[model samples]
Target: MSIERTPATPDPNWDRLVADLTAAPAEKPVGPVLQKTADVPVNRPDLLGDMPLTPEWVRTPAGWRTRAEVGKVNSVRAFRRWVRRQSTEHGHGAQVFRGMHRTFLWIQGTEGVQVATARREVQQAQGDYKTAKGHHGRRLIPGKEKYKRRAEMDKAFAGSVTAMSRYKAAQRDARTRRAARGALAAAAVAVPEGAGIYLIGGTGGVIATGSALLAFALIGRRTAGGELYHDHDVKFGDTLKLTDSMLNKIYRDAKVIGADEVVELLTPCTLTADGKAWEVTLDLPSGTPLKKALTAKTGVASALGVKVQQLHQAPGDREGRLQLRVSLHLPFTGKPDPGPLLDLNCINLWRAIPMGVNLRGQEVSTSWVERSGLFGGEPGAGKSAAANDLLLAAALDPTVALYLCDGKAGADLTPFEPIAAMHDTDGEPERLLEILEHIWTVEIPRRRALAKEHGSRKLTAAMAAKDPRVNLAVLLVDEWSSYGAAADRRVREEMERLLRLIVQQGRALGIITLCATQKPDADSVPSGIRDILSIRWAMRCLTPQASDTILGQGYAAAGHNAQDILKSQRGVGIYMDGEGAEPELTRGYYYDDDEVDLILGRAFELRAKAGTLPAGSVPLADQLRAVDDDDARVLAVLLDTFDAHLDGEGEPAEWLPGSVLVDALADAGTALSADSLGRLVVRTDDEKAKRPWLGSRVVGYPRSRVLITVRDRFGMGE
Candidate 1:
């Protein structure tokens, strides 16, 4: 269909000039005009002067129809409005389409001006070259001076030709980038806002349904000069375009903020980009280190309208350049795209473990064959997920032996009991003590012997692959605070000491310690051991103090702020792999339970295929049954806390109240609740347990029976 419209001015030269330099709009008819004629009456008076009339009315070619007849002819404006409405319904989102149209127009205007400017300069150079060539044959004033005059004109002509050639080359280079200009003009990444539909069910239930992934298709260019378009409704692998203005805004806002505080920063350089980051390279003021400007990362972030943790700075020395990587909305959207489980499918143990992602959405992984790492953050900050990345890495490697612990009451690590050589989750001091003892006594000594046998100072994956006897051992503690929370005082301290020893001495033996905790403070994880963990990952923290506690003493002051990460940014964090390097922005891989289980299943198959899976070993249930055998820890606590006098008024009392025993146990660093003591001393349901083990039914352990048990077990008696 065609519409009456004013014709656009013919600009054949300009149109052809920009044809390849910009993305053309989709083919469509001229847009319709929305005049006031669309408004009309649908009904009319029953009669004019008592004339009969029907109920329908509309515009017609013959005349204005009354209430009686309807025909094909209708209001031209109404028909055009309907066409426009349908086009809009089928087009790209209204706001996005408009924004794209404006951006494309702007690009076209700028490119055309650039071409014209080059052409005009070339024309001027061509005129100069012609003048120089024409003057080369000027007549000589005398027979002797003829050759000298001709030589001077020849040199001038040569200079003009060179100038003209340079101008022509520049114009040619611009003409060659027509397709790149088209791609650049079409680049865009803003997602349309989604709508929330509340659905009410029976029993007055309501639910809102929508997916951020469904808001729009992901758009990007995989390589330079590649196609520029959206991947049709991509669910995973989303990326955002980082523009120069967006980067400049971050730096400008930081300066505006710092200027108020008497801090002056150097002018920013041009912003550049690659697949990984939008890089801004500039120098700080003379004599001022880049670290000084980097310290205002939070200031820049607030100006950019993001949480502090979402911004990261990679500072250089005073003599070098400073780089500010602005993530903007990238971290908010770029994360583990929905997909299959990542696991033992990768053969390279060195790079197979997925840590998280860098600012550019690149995969960041760890090679933990002989490294010690500590992961820390507040509760629900994805600390466990980061730890799981390493665990999943080790699990996929058939030559790695696993030792896992979950200090919480829940069973996050229980799923791996089948593969682990030793595992604990209940925080039973005795159980953990034995597990540590086994590693310290049997595991370390064997690894040391294997290391000494080989001439290499450290055991590598190649060595482990060659010799099955010298496999890698991974010790992963899910919760560090649980150790300090143990009921047994000495056992609690011993657990901390053992973690330090493993990280300090286990490097050459191919043993690594990975401790994850919500509390990275000294009370939970001692500073002495924390420094030993070279690879530190600080996820979302609650405050600056907590952020500093996890990264280092001066980490937060240096501008790596993890406390500002939003809750929605679950698996994102700041990472420092070694000392003396600035922390970089990173996102941890987010693998759910089902995804983790998939890797677990594959790991089991790999272990079984390699003949490394546990075979002919005692069942886990059997191990639980043997936990109470001998009961040496109970006997020792009884002997230590025994009262010599009844209520301290008579000769030493052989038996004391259960309450006293509970307090004494806690003081001794052995956490035992009063209710648990009741179950042990006072008999409960006969169907539940055999009977109370203590001889005295009133409250605490009897001194006589305790002496007998101790004498029989440890050969010690009072």
Candidate 2:
């Protein structure tokens, strides 16, 4: 267990502290210092001048005052002591050495201060050990054996020194041998077969330590006779990017020329000749600027567009063939253009905005989830229908598999069951949660495996082509806040983890999620999930905080409301694509329930014929399958019951107790317990007098004035 520290006790000497804190000390005039020794003779003039000394005093009408006055001298001295302790403990010489340059000390018998500058008395290095101590004297030296023992000790150290030198020499010889071996290995590399090696003679010649003179060396010559360019081990179809210095020797020496003043080029070359005698004439348009001309002639001639040679001749040759070698000429001093070949294909956020999505070009649609996106808004903001339309567009693609979990039961997403794979009221919140996690867990590992197999740093073309798993899976979640609210803590944590990872890596794996929620608060949308979702699709929100939470700060400040958004109609969305994807108001694509049904009917037909296709690739039968008869019946029941309740068709019903109540609730599928029913009955009666009811009331004995029926069975009571 760790002990906690608390504040220190109050001062014990209260009377002294009070007196000293309040009272002022007597002020005295500054005085001069009487020098103990002004001139001490020393061999080093530099050392003597560096020592601290007293200065002359000046006399004034106020009295004599010393020119030097110190302030905060005690504090400075304490700080210096602390710093020295730290340096000694830490073993950093500079930490202590830097402090010695300046220090302060209080003058004795005066309330004044003195500043002193210090210089090191001894040399830091061993070579100057003797010279350094001359100023301090021999007493300062640490070890002394006297005269007799010194000779033997010195000889022993000398012997050790000799042994060290031999050891160092052996190390050097070993390094030299290693270097020679490297040179021989390099020399063994063979030139490509048939590529002639020509010796372009150098001015100087040398032999081994004891070798006789050889024949006259081969000097500079044209490729026709004995002279040839040595073909080094250049592999086939390799582009040689040459430095300017090499170009001067290669092309300038050969006097080869070409056209095009500005040559921004890259290319490869093929060797026509075998052996070192590789030579060819690259004819050029005359009077072209040598730099521009050479780029056009040699660069264009070589398989690699880069120009490797200037003149085709070897060095020292008076005349030679104009052969095109493969090489690149770097721009002298300019920024390299990183075009499509090198950089990520980032889109401009400005141009991609949907036509009416951003009224002021402020927002753009995100290409995040293929075409569809998350919709953030308040209740009755047309968020549900708007989301439906976007998903409908995505459903057009056969390769895209859409899974929508409508936590509003089936209310929000049920209309799209005809076109999209949907989980409705039939799905338990727990099962929906499980399905989401399973999709991500399986997907994440598969993506990782694909990235590893292709040796790709990310989802590159190479990996995507090889891995069938990297396909689009559009996951649509309506009212995610409700999903989280209904889920247990463990389930919520799992959802958070899955969403965080999916939002981060989903873009590369072609998996996209369109998560919609009425609540867009810090607590509702986690930080990790929000960071990667720079793309936003916002609807009208109740408050400024909610709006800003969805579309950045100041969105609600603009006064958009449900009336304004609904006026825009369904299938209309603001597009925010690319980098600057601020929320753009867009007219989203729309499809009615009939159109969606027809399309999915076709898809279902394909699915039935094809059996189970991959996640993204839906079979035609699966896409176009008719809604099952059982599902239709359940949906009809919910609609009819809710409508009847809303229309006030269900009349006032009498209250029944205990067994009677349980049986009634069971038939209605309300599933309340007898105790729960009793509590609700009591509370309902108590509050009935306070708030008038719009629906039927049942007046009975003991439990009098209890509301036996819902406001309206189909919700028309109000």
Candidate 3:
């Protein structure tokens, strides 16, 4: 009864009261609050001092970045550097010696053991076969036996004999092969020793002894199951050992990837075939591109603890793939080695020219045939030295006719004057213009005609060998800007036009023009000429603009900036072979003054032997005066006869009779007859103008020199 009375007393405002308890409180009127909005400026100058403006690490002694950089430059690193220098200087020769020794030991030891083993196996097999044969013979019965028994015995005996014969033959064949190998090994050793002694005398004996000892050591180590050296032990310097973890760390530090992302290696990290660099191919994350990696080359180099120049990157086979090369050391830092042409007595222009070595420590050779090249750099940037690589190579080839125009007025190119067909070092723009015109009008046309006569569209080595007129012609213009800077504008314009024509049309005719300039600007090297040149070498420049002028427009943007080259690295340059080829770093081979002299001397001898020396070496008048008395008499009579037959213009008759010259010689009291004159003309013609005064009309007919040539020869010019 009490619970029913309490239930009946429920309030009507209970739902409203519960809703009011759950609902939000009503908004109260409040004054403006002092909230610091992001857009608002702080008002307290004292509290907002430079403390917040500067980074927190600036107030501390050192930041993480600074500390990391400092940690890398310590005594341990210095000691490592010292160790690397020592290994580079002293260990290379030792490694080479050890390698040679090992080779010899393996050849001798393995071959000897193989021969002995083969001989023993052959003897044992033969003995076993003979014993088996003897037993079979003893068991055989000759006359009386059941048919099946006799037949079975014969079949078994025959099968045994066949098997034994096969085994014996196989053993004998093995022994013969092993014996041949041993003989070859002995010959290999003997031949090198004999050649070494014959070539280097007593020094070769010491080398041979050292080689033999090394070989023994190598063989002993191999037999004892020990390796002479490991790849890691022989590493050049503190070369980075590339691994997945290391790569991931490098990528993260370089900012090439986010902290949560990892680069996927498309290929395993490995040493290059040259062993001068470590190569790896990898792919970036899904949204990343290869261009990001290439653009961040310096960052990656910093992460790898190397100079920016030591790291090179190229696009891989597909999108988002990067191929990276980390050089073990800075390339071309040491004194440059001599050129390959120094050892070669002669060279052929048809082959690629041994220009220099590239960044990969591999030799770089470029073909100049059907191509023109432009080399440019600032003064002392090895512009002339790079030109000399091609010039000296051309000089060594007797078949290449060299025409040099040295505008620098220096002796750098003077050594080649003796071998040059046309050499001008006076920096005279008029002379250069004349030379270019001659090349354009005379040389190009002559080469075209000769090529046509030989049924060839282009000049070839074979054609050059057969005909001297069809040889390759190379025109080198050092300091090409000197011509453009000439006082006369007309001369400069003509030169540029002729150069453009020569570069565009003369390549197929076996004419190559190599132009070099210290100032590689639009004014110095006109775009019309520079654009047609396929091969361009840009050495150290003052700006990327200058590099673009030499290599082509937009090349500097493509990461081939010659200005990036160190001033200390003189001959190093960016080489662009063609429009499609990527520019690469190359160090031109050094050619000092002494080396140039030697090369010139050798070239002189080669040209002299080939009879390709320039005619300017001897004066024509002097040559004419040096003729024998009989030749002089015949020449005098021929000159007189030509004078009598000359037209009013003083031109010699197109066709003159041998009899007429002979009659004149007789009148001059010469004993030479008409037949003798004909024979003399034929004989002198075969000598390729041994006597410059002598001229011929038909094959058998003798003709006289023109009036001007006669006057010039006799020094009778006005």
Number of backbone collisions per candidate, in order? Answer: 15, 80, 1
lDDT of 2 by residue, 1-718 (tens): 1211322565565545344424442132122122111131111111112221212111221112111111133245445644654444222233233222211111111111111101111112222433333423445444553443455445545555555555556556555655665454333322211122223222111221011111101111122243333323222223132332233333333344322222221111221111111222333234433344333343333423232221121111112223333312221112212211112112221113222232221223334432334567776555665565445444444445567787667555665454454444443668676666766777667766776777764554344356544445677777666677788888888878877777667766666677677776755566567545655656655555665666665433332222234422343333344344433344433344665566455544443333323333442222223234332222232223333333245632322224444554466555666575555444444433322234644422122223122121211112
lDDT of 2 at 245: 29
lDDT of 3 by residue, 1-718 (tens): 0112123568786555444434443242121111111222211111123332122232233334443443454345546755664464233454455555665465445444544655565566556655555544555544444454555556655655665565566566656766676677666567667777888987986687667555544444332234343333322234445556678778888898999999887555644433456667788998987667776776788788787777777776688888777876677788998789889999988889899998766689988888899999988899888998999999899888888898777787778877788888988888888888999999999998888999988888788778867778899887777766763888888888888898888999999888899886777778778788889999999998998888877767656778878888899999887667777889999988889899988988777656576866633333343454456556656665665787668876544655566677778788787566655555344522222224643332434333344445444322
Among all candidates shown, the one with the greatest TM-score: 3
Model 1, 277-392: lDDT tens digits are 23344554445555556677767766655555445567545553565565433464544664223623735454446677777555666666667888888788888778777777
Candidate 3's displacement at residue 42, Å, is: 72
Query: Which ranges of candidate 2 are over 4 A from the true structure?
Result: 1-366, 369-373, 415-427, 460-469, 555-575, 605-718
Query: TM-scores of the models, in the given order?
Result: 0.50, 0.34, 0.55
- How would you order the candidates by lDDT, starting with the best? 3, 1, 2
- Name the better of 1 and 3 by TM-score: 3
> Would you list the C-alpha lDDT of every candidate in the order shown?
0.59, 0.41, 0.70
Q: Which window of 10 residues has the lowest lDDT sum in candidate 2?
A: 208-217
* lDDT for 158 (candidate 1): 69
Candidate 1 has an lDDT of: 0.59
